[model samples]
Target: MKRRHFIGAAVASAAALGAPMLRAQGRPRVVVVGGGAGGATVARYLAKDSAGALDVVLVEPNVVYSSCFFSNLTLADLRSPESLEHGYDRLGAFGITLVHDRATGVDRARREVTLGAGGVLAYDKLVLAPGIDFVPGSVTGWSEADDEIFPHAYRGGAQVALLRAQLGAMRPGGTFALVAPPNPYRCPPGPYERVSMVACLLSRINPTAKVLVLDPKPSFSKQALFEDGWARHYPGVVEWIGPDAGGAAVEVRPGVGEIVVAGAVLRVDVANIIPAQKAGAIADAAGLTEGGWVPVEPLALATKADPAVHVLGDAAAQGDMPKSGFSANSQAKVVANAIRAELTGSRAFPPRYANTCWSAIAPGDGVKVGATYSAGEGKIAAGAGFISQAGEAAELRAATYAESFAWYDAISEDIFG
Candidate 1:
C-alpha cells in the first residue's frame, strides 16, 4: 500500500524516559547494535524514512564491515577484497549517530545500553543484530586459540585473506581440508560454496592439489547441483565425505597439521575448521537468548524476553528463514516499519519476508535456493520457493553468477545508503 507517505502526528507520544541528557533531546531514539547487514539497513531506513522524526544511533565496533556472502569469491580470486569492505560514513549522511563502540550490556528494565568505551545510550527501542559467535567445545581438540594454525575463514575480512595466503603458499599436490559445521548455522550453503570456490582456484594453480570436504551432515543444500558441477569442472581433484563415511567424528592436530577421522589420521597442508556457532555474546549477556539464540516474535522480530528489544539476523531464532544477509536485510525493513509506526504514528503494513541464497559453484557457474515467508501462529512459515536444478544449461548458470554480482551491488547500496 501507500506506506511511504508518513502522516504527520504528535512526536511526544514516541518519547521514552531516559537520562536527563537524553530526555533533553526531546525525540524518540532507536539504538541499533551491530552495524552489519540488518543493523545498517534498519538504522538507515528508520532515520531516512522517519524524516527527522526519530533519533537513531548505530553502535558498531568496526568502522568498515566486510560481507560474508561474497567473501568466498574473494578467496577464489574472483572478487577483490576491497569490494567487500564498506564504511559507515554514508550511513551518517542520513543523520544517524554512528557509535563506533561495542555494546557490552543491555539494561532492559531501564532501557539503557552500556558501551565498551565507557558510555551509555538510552533508547526507546533497541535492535540487536550482532551476528554470530563460535560455540565453545563444539569440535574436539580444537578451539579459537588454534585459529591461526587452522583458520576458519567463515567471516569476511582478514581471515579470508589469511586463508588465501596459506593456500598460495601450500606445496603443490598438498591436500586442503575443510571441516564443515553442523546444522542451524548461518548460511546453509556457505561451507559447500566455499569448497567449490577453493576447488576453482586450486584447479587452475595447483592442478594436483586435493580438495577435501568433511561434512558433519549427511547432505547439504543444492547437493545434487554442487556434485554435478564438481564432477564436471574439477573431477579427480575434489572429494566429499559425509557422516556416513565417518565425516562427523574428527579431530584436528594443530601441532602436527593432521586430522584424525574415524580413528584414521590424515596429514593436511591447510585446514579450514568451521565450528558450531551461536548468537553474538552480547545476546547472552543481555539475557535475551534461550538455547544460545534470541527467540523472537516473527511479526516484528521483537524478542520474547522484552518486546522493546528486537533481535535480527544470525542472532535471532526466527523460524523458516535461513540466516543470510538477504534474510537479515528483509527482516530489517519489516522491523523499521513496525518501529516507526509504534514510535512515530506512521503507517503499519503487513510484514512479509523473503530470502535468496546464491552460490557460485565454479567460475561463471552459480546455483540458488530461495523462499518467501509469512508470520505464523508461533513461528515464521515458509511459502513458495525455488532451487537450481541438477541439469541446468551452461548459459543459465553463467547468468545466475552474473545476477549474484548485481544483487551484491544493490544490497550494498540499500544497506549503506
Candidate 2:
C-alpha cells in the first residue's frame, strides 16, 4: 500500500553441520519447504541432532520472516514490525542449507522436489510447512482488483507494511473494518486482537474513529479475554458482529470496498479480510489432502496419506490445534525427532502436539490458552488441554501471557538461530 516496503538485510550463511560429521549424506536427505516456524524448527532439529549425518535443505522464498504470533499486537502498534522480523542466518549456522527459491511441484514417486529454478531436489523424506493461502471467493467483494485498498496481511513482510501505512494515514473520525474469516482458520483469536490493537493505536490520535469486526463465526478463540480487555480499554471504540448479528457476509465487492451480509451493506475506509484456507500448493500437489488440509499421523505429522512425506504448520490437518506459530514450532520439533529415530536406526515413537495461542488486546495486557495433546484414532484429540474457557485473572492474564512474547523468541531461536 505504501509504494513499497523495505526488505530486510540479507544474512550471511553460517554452516551449522557438515556431511562427514553427520554421517547422513548417503543415509537419506530430508528437504523442508517453507522457512516459517515449522520448517525452520524441523530443519534445525534434524541438522542439529543428526550431527551432520542427514542432508537438510530449507526452501523458502524469503530470507527474513515475520511471525504471525504477535501480529495482532503489531497491528495495534504496541510492537514495531521490526520486533517480528527474523532471517535464516541462524539456520545456515546450524548447517542447514538455506535456499531462496519458490517451490514449483513435487515428483512424489520420484522423490524429487521441483523448484522454480527448474532444478529438482531429491529427498528421501519431504516435510512441508509452506503454510496457508487465502481462497479469493470467500469474501464476496474481495479480488485482485481490491489488493491496493485492503490487504489480508496474514502473511509477512510488505503486507504488514501496507496495513500499517493505511492505519497511519487514516483521518480522524474514520472507520476501520476487519473482515474475519470462517472458523478453523489461522490464528483463531488473531482477527479480534488485530482490531483491538488498531483501536488502541487510534484511541490516542483519532479518538473518535471506530474499529468494527465482521466475524464469520459465532465464537472464536480466547473470546472472553478479548472482550474483557476491549470493554475496559476500548469500550465504544470497538464493536463486533458475530454470525447472529449478520457478521457472516455472503459476498464481497472489491471495486466499492463493500461487504454484504444478510442483505445488509457496509463500506469502510480500511478492510482486512482472511478467507478459508488449505495447505500451500506444494502440499496439495504431493497428495497431502483428505479434504482441504493435509491429514497426518498425530505424533510425527507424517502424511497419513503418504508415509514418506510430513506436513507441519497451518498446512497440516491438525484439527484440534489452532494453526499458530507456536503449534507449528512444537509440531516440527516432534517431526524432527521422529525423522531422526527412523533414519538414525532408532525408533522415535509416535507423536502428539503441544500448542498454545496467545493474544494481546492491548500493550501489557494478554490472554492465552494452551494444551498437551495425544494421538487419537484418526486425529489428535484434547488430552490435557483446555478446549475453551472464560474468566480473566489480571495476574495469570498478565504474567503468563507475557510469556507469549517469549514463545516467539524461543521458536525463532530454535528454528533459524
Candidate 3:
C-alpha cells in the first residue's frame, strides 16, 4: 500500500462498517487529555475503531507535537527538529475533535474536564495521558527558569532546540555535562543515548571535547551495550559516574556553569539536567497519583482511583514497562480496545502489550531492548524480551539504526498519518 493512503484507507474502512449499534441512547463521549503518543493514539483508535459511535475529543496545548523519541538526532545534526514536528490535521480528518488547549483540571465527581481556556467537557470515559511533569526542587538550583541556561530537553520541542544551540556554541575542548534522572522516569535509555549523540557531534567539530554523565541510578537500561558502543565509536570522549560513585550526590549551579559531584566542583561549558518526574498536574488534581505516578489496572489501564478514568504512557505506573513513546503507543491500543468493547459490546480479548526502545549510539550505530508483556496480579509483567549483545557486527548495528527510523515513520503514521 502507498504510504500516503494508509491512514485515509484505514479510516475509510472503519467508517464504512458504520458504528456498531451503540448500547446507549446518545453517543458516548471519550475525552483524551494530552496529544502525545499515548493520548493521540487512544483518541485516534477509539474514534477510528468505533466509527461514529463515540464522540472523541483530544485536548492539547500545542498544535504541533515535537517527538522526544528522535529529538536526540537533532542534537547530532543527523535530523532537523522541524522534521520531528507533527500536526493534528490528520486526526481531524478522521472525524475526531481537536481542542488546542491545556487541560487544567479533572472533575472526577462531575465527570468533566476543565480547560485552561475556560470550558468544561463531560466524558463518559476520560483517558488521561498527560505524560510527565518535572518534580519541583528535584534537582538542586534548577527550575524551569534555568532551562534556558541548562536545557533538560526531556519534553522535546523548544528545549531540544535550546540544547542543540548550546551544543553548537560550546568552545572547542570544553566540557559538556549531563545529569541523568533516576529510574521510573520517561525513556530509561534516553540520557545515555543523548550522551552518545553529543559525543558524536563533538567528535566532529571539537575532537578534544569531553562528555560527562552523572546518573542518579546505579545501573541503567542497555548499560553494557551503550558502554561498548561508546568505547568503540568514541573512545576516551565520554565518562559516566554511577550512583555508587556519588552520581546521586550532585548539584548544579547553572549561573556559574559549575557542577558539584560528591563534594567536588567541576566547571562545564554546557549542562543538561534531567530531574525526577511525575504525572502531569491534572492527574494530581484528579487524585490519580499515589507515588508521583498514576496506578492503573493492567488489563484495561483504568486508573485505580477511578475506573471511568484511564491513564496511559509516562503518567501510568504499569510495572515492567519502560516509559517510552513505544510503550505508551502499545498501552493506548489495549485501553482503546477495552473501551470499545464496553461501549459497543464488541469482543474483547485479553490484553497483550509490547514495546521496543531503540537508541542511536552514533550515526550508524543503534541498539535496542524490548519485551512482550501480559497482565498478572494487577500489573503488567514482562514475559519475554531481547537486548542487543556486546560485540555485534557493524552491519547489524547499522541495520538496527535503520530499523529505528522505519519504526519511527510507521508509528508516526499510525498515530498522526
Best by lDDT: 1
Q: TM-score of every model?
A: 0.94, 0.90, 0.94
| lDDT digits (tens) for residues 57-124 of candidate 2 | 78888867887777767666677889888977767766687767777888777777777755566777
Candidate 3 differs from the real structure by a C-alpha RMSD in angstroms, to one decimal, of: 6.6
Choose 2 or 3, whichever is better by lDDT: 3
**Global lDDT of each candidate:** 0.89, 0.76, 0.88
Which TM-score value belongs to model 1?
0.94
Which order, best to worst by TM-score? 1, 3, 2
Across residues 272-309, which tens digit of lDDT does each residue of candidate 1 receive? 99999899999999999898899999899999989999
Across 64-142, the per-residue lDDT of candidate 3 in tens digits comes to 9999999999989998898899998888776787777887888788787877766666778999999999998988889
Candidate 1: misplaced stretches above 4 Å?
Answer: 1-21
* All candidates: CA RMSD (Å): 6.2, 6.1, 6.6
Instruction: Indicate which candidate wins on TM-score.
Output: 1
Q: So what's the TM-score on candidate 2?
A: 0.90
